[model samples]
Target: MPNYTLLTRQLEALLDDRDWLINAAQTCAFIMQQVPELNWAGFYLQRQPELLTLGPFQGKPACNPIPFSKGVCGGAARSRQTQRIDDVHAIADHIACDAASNSELVVPILRQGTLWGVLDLDSPRHGRFDEVDQAGIEALVEVFNARTDLPDFLSSH
Candidate 1:
């Protein structure tokens, strides 16, 4: 198992700036570089109500504009909860952005009680994440929230 304590500390140090976009992007790269067996690590920003648009990621291409009524990411966004799935194929509505991704972990990112986005991690190994990972990632997301000054309205222009 990876040392989440060290990882979170590294994340805190990596995020020197408060720019949401830059931090989000760096977080993805950090997770991808540090974590093992991961195929994808990224974010899906909820730019509109009940919708998730693609954000910074460290992986191949991905799906975009997911609705609240769809896949694992959607479930996390809609329910405002973290989702840890051991098998992606078992999910009826699993979004297959990468066929090699067998498992998934999605953590809901909130800003002052409002849904901001989700930090998504996909692994090629089955059951890649567990309770420890869940807790650690949640803590990392909290650090991100604390460090980032995410504005209420982010213009796409």
Candidate 2:
């Protein structure tokens, strides 16, 4: 299991700035570097009322403009909860942005009480993300929520 406490601290330290995207970018890099077996780490901002557009990420190209009705990221955004898929192939509606990604974890990013977007992580290892990871990522998302300002980003979107 990852020492998420330490990771959260590291993220908080970097999040001193007011720019939300800067913080999001740093968080993506932090997750990709600190976490093992991760093929992708990123955020998907809510571009439309029912769609998510790719935001800051540290990986290969990803599926852009994902609707709120599809995939793990979509489900998390739609439900306002975390979605941790042990095996992406087993999920009928799984979006195959990267063929090598066999598992996924999507944590909704909320501003105040409204849905901001999601913090998404993908891995080539099936079952790579468990309860431990879900908890850690969720905690990290809280750190993100508390530190970053998203009013300008959200209003302009």
Candidate 3:
């Protein structure tokens, strides 16, 4: 695994730019580059209480406007917890934005105790994400949550 300490530092520096969209985009791009076996890395911001709109992502086209009621991403958002599936295919309702993805890790992003959004990472290889990854990604999500200003994307309703 790459050095998460270094990665986190780099993330902090990038976030110094303070343009949420650009920083979010850089976060996706940076993780995709550092992590191995990952085919997709991205964010889905809560546009409303029941919907998540796609943000910066690195991969093939992904599912946009994910509802709060469905899929792994939805599960994380609704529960405000991380979802790390060893085999996404086993989940009866797994949303296959990329058919190649066999495993996934979705971490919910919270800001001031509110459901902000999620950082979703996918891999073509099963058992791709483990505890180490969960820890690292959770740290990354902390960086994102602390630095990002998300009101620009969320809706009042």
Candidate 4:
């Protein structure tokens, strides 16, 4: 298990740039660097209705424009809830951007009750994430949200 307490403090310190784009990029890099066994760490920005466009990420090439009705990222966006899967292969609609990714954790990013996007983390090992990880990552995300001035992308919705 990671030292989430320390990770949280580090994230807060690293987020010196409050710009959403910069923060997103830094957050992805931080997760990939600090977390072990992660194959992918990134963000899926909901620029359009019911769709998530690829944002800053660290990994191999990825799938673009995931719909809210499809995949784990979509499920998190559609439901506005965190989705932590022990085995991505078991998900019938799992979007296999990386065949090596066996597990996934996606947290919805909301601004003023409106959807902004999602923070997605994928791992090559099955069951790589547990409740502790979920809570820790969620807290880290809270730090992102608190520090960054994320635009209300869906304000017009």
Scored by lDDT, the top model is 4
lDDT for model 2 comes to: 0.91
Query: What TM-score would each prediction reach against the true structure?
Result: 0.96, 0.95, 0.94, 0.97
**Residue 157 displacement (Å), model 4:** 9.5
lDDT of 3 by residue, 68-129 (tens): 88899999999999999999999988889999999999999887788778999999999999
Q: Please provide, for model 4 over 1-157, each residue's C-alpha lDDT reduced to its tens digit, 9 standing for 90 to 100.
A: 8999999999999999889999999999999999999999999998888999999999999999999999999999999999999999999999999999999999998888888999999999999999999999999999999999987666656
Q: What's model 4's overall lDDT?
A: 0.94
lDDT of each: 0.92, 0.91, 0.89, 0.94
The number of the candidate with the highest TM-score is 4
| TM-score, cand. 2 vs. native | 0.95
* lDDT preference between candidates 1 and 4, better one: 4
**What tens-digit string does per-residue lDDT give for candidate 2 at 1-157?**
6899999899889889878889889999999999999999999988678889999999999999899999999999999999999999998888999999999999998876788889999999999999989999999999988888786355674
Backbone clashes in model 2, listed as residue pairs: none
**Clash counts for the predictions, in order:** 0, 0, 0, 0
For candidate 2, give the lDDT of residue 152.
36
